[model samples]
Target: MVEIKEIEKSFGRLNVLKGVSVSIPSGKVVAVLGPNGSGKTTLIKCILGLVIPDSGNIIIGNDNVKNSWSYRKNIGYLPQIARFPENLTVNELFRMIQDLRKGYANIAEAERCKEELVSVFNIQSFLNKHLRSLSGGTRQKVNVILSLMFDPDLFIFDEPTVGLDPISCVRFKENILKQKEKGKTIVLTTHILSEVDEMADEIIFLLEGKIYYKGSPDELKLQQQEATLERAIARLLEKNDNKINNQLPGKNN
Candidate 1:
């Protein structure tokens, strides 16, 4: 559904994404895994057209994201931190989003989806509360509801489960599975390995702005000689460290 071709981006002298390339097929759940400063967020932003790459192309379906804004209507993005107008009540905020997306989304379906999401996340009562009055978990639930209400073709969730309670977390995962079952393409970024194991069909592991590993979770575990996804990732990092150390000057002196 999305193809990134030899993308490179740098901020001042600090390079972020260097020649990164990957294709995410439709109906697949791909997990973007990386430690801090690994360019995961930057890569996602590039795809969203929020951060322009120095040189490269991002293709969403047949449309190139360059100088485009319409394609974003088909994307449901839930950022790690969503800031809403504090004065708006939850219901009012949802209504405002619906108004903003009136032409892009089917109003009837959006309303039905919002109802279902509010129920699933159990945020019906919080709907009447102001955004500033809700707790972090409540606000997170609202964010999830808003993202899924439109049933977009592509879903980009960055640390989506953060601030969600255990029950809400499980519900969120279940909702993601339901979306996958409907043949939607999903791009997920999270530090939670167990969540990746459960929902991801493919893994894109990045290190220092490059794709260090890309494959199925089980394949990664086998290649890294580890029993769990967490351990496998650790082994992969160790290999990177070893490779870097081996290249240092005067290493054998």
Candidate 2:
């Protein structure tokens, strides 16, 4: 459902994505994995049109996302760091978002989804509380609810389970599975290898602004000759350490 072709992005002297290409099919959960500064977030931002690529294209369904905003209506994005108005109460925030998206989203469906999420995440008790007063986990739950309530065709979650309690994490996984069953496409970025192992159908591993590996978790482990996803990823990184170091700025030839 998503296609990226020879995408490249550079910021001043720093190149973040270098001719990266991948195709994500519908109803699949794809995990984008990379170490710090590997351009995973930049790639995602490019797909969402938050960051424009210097070359190539990102297409969702048949729509090229470049210089476009309407395509975003089909995507539900949960950013790595969700920042909301501190003074707004949870209910107020929901109402405001609903207002902003009135013409785009089905009001009855959005309300039904919100009710289900509030119950599932146990957000009812804090509905009247100010966002500033909620704990990080609670705030994260709010973020999840906001992103999921629209029932968009595509879901992009960046560190979605960060700060979530154990039970909430389990619920989040269940929710993802439910979405997958409904044939929605999902793309997520997380440092938790275990979560990827448990949830991802495919993995896209990036190194220094390029795709290093793209396959299933099991395929990755087998390819790296490792028993587990964590070890496989570690081995892959270790194997490429020299290449990565040499590519760093100021490294002597």
Candidate 3:
């Protein structure tokens, strides 16, 4: 459902993304895993049009994201941090969203979806609370509910399970599986490998602003002669370190 080819994004003299390319198919779950400062966030932001790429093309379905806003109607995104007007109650915030999307969302449909999401994410208990009064976990739930409010063709989540408890995290994963069964494409960034193994059909391993590898969890294991995803990643990093050391002109014993 999404295609990025030779994408490059640079911040002044520092380049964050260089010649990155990946294709995510529809109705599948794709997990992107990377260490800190790996440009995973940058890549996702580029897809959302938050950070414009210096070069390369991002295509969503048949629409070129740079050239069309129409494709945006089919996307739903949940950021790691959600910012809301502090004074608004959860109900009011949800209502405000309904008002904004009235032209695009059928009133009954949107209301039904919103109610389901609020219940699914267990946000109903905090419906009367203002954004400023809610806890981090509660706020995260609200953000997730907002993403599902549209029931769009594609769902993008960045560190979506960050603040949730175990039960809540399981529920979130189940919800993702349900969405995939309905033929919705999903792209999520996560540092949790166990969760990725359970939820992802394909894994995109991004490192230092580029795609280090992309394959199924089992395939990745085979790449490193290991039977586990964690081992595979450990081996990949060690291999990269050796490669870097080999390139140095003067080396230590």
Candidate 4:
């Protein structure tokens, strides 16, 4: 579904992504796991064309993402932080997005999907309320609904369960699984290892703007000789840290 080849990005003195490359197959849930400053979000932005990479190719389906905007129409994106017009009511916000994407495949189907998502996320009671007045979890629910309403082919969720309540988080997982079952590609970035263990078909572990490990969760645990997904990732990071320290200037091997 997506292919990233030798992607590189920098911000003045800081190199964010260094020749990162990964291929995401269709109908799979891939978790992009990393610590802070690992360039997970940067990679996602590159794929979405929100941030252009300094070099490399991001090909979704068959088209390169550079200087392209139309590929986004087939991709549903839920940002890590959703910032909307504070004064707009939930209903109004929904209407605005529906209007903006009026060219979606089927108008009636999109509306029906929106209504279904509203009910599933249990946001009906707050539809009339302004976005600024909603709780973080509630707002996140609205964000999820808006992203899923159009039923895009690929779903990209960044920190999707951040503020969700336990039940809501469960519902969100169920919905994502349903989408996967229907053969939709999913790419998620989150710090929650347990969620990754539960939902991810493959894990792409990133560190210092590079893919440190990419495989199934079980394979990672076994490879690292760790008992749990969290421990496995921690061990990987520690090993990388030691390796880097050993290679530092004036350091003895």
Clash count for candidate 2 is: 0
Report each candidate's C-alpha RMSD, comma-separated, in the order given: 1.1, 2.8, 1.4, 1.4
Deviation (Å) of 158 in candidate 3: 0.2
* Residue 104, model 2: Cα distance from true site in angstroms: 1.9
In the range 20-83, model 2's lDDT, one tens digit per residue, is: 9999999999999998999988999888999999999999987999867888888999989889
**TM agreement with the true structure for every prediction:** 0.97, 0.93, 0.96, 0.96
Candidate 4, which ten residues in sequence have the lowest lDDT sum? 98-107
**Candidate 1 Cα outliers beyond 4 Å, as residue runs:** none
Q: Candidate 3 lDDT, tens digit per residue, 70-100?
A: 7777888999898999999999998998897
Q: Any runs in candidate 2 off by more than 4 Å, and if so which?
A: 242-253
Off by over 4 Å in 3: none
Backbone clash count, each prediction separately: 0, 0, 0, 0
Candidate 1 is scored at a TM of 0.97
Error of 3 at 119 (Å): 2.0
- In model 4, the Cα lDDT at residue 245 comes to 93
Mark the 10 consecutive residues where model 2 has the least summed lDDT. Answer: 237-246
Model 3 gets an lDDT of 0.89
Using lDDT as the measure, name the better of candidate 2 and candidate 3: 2
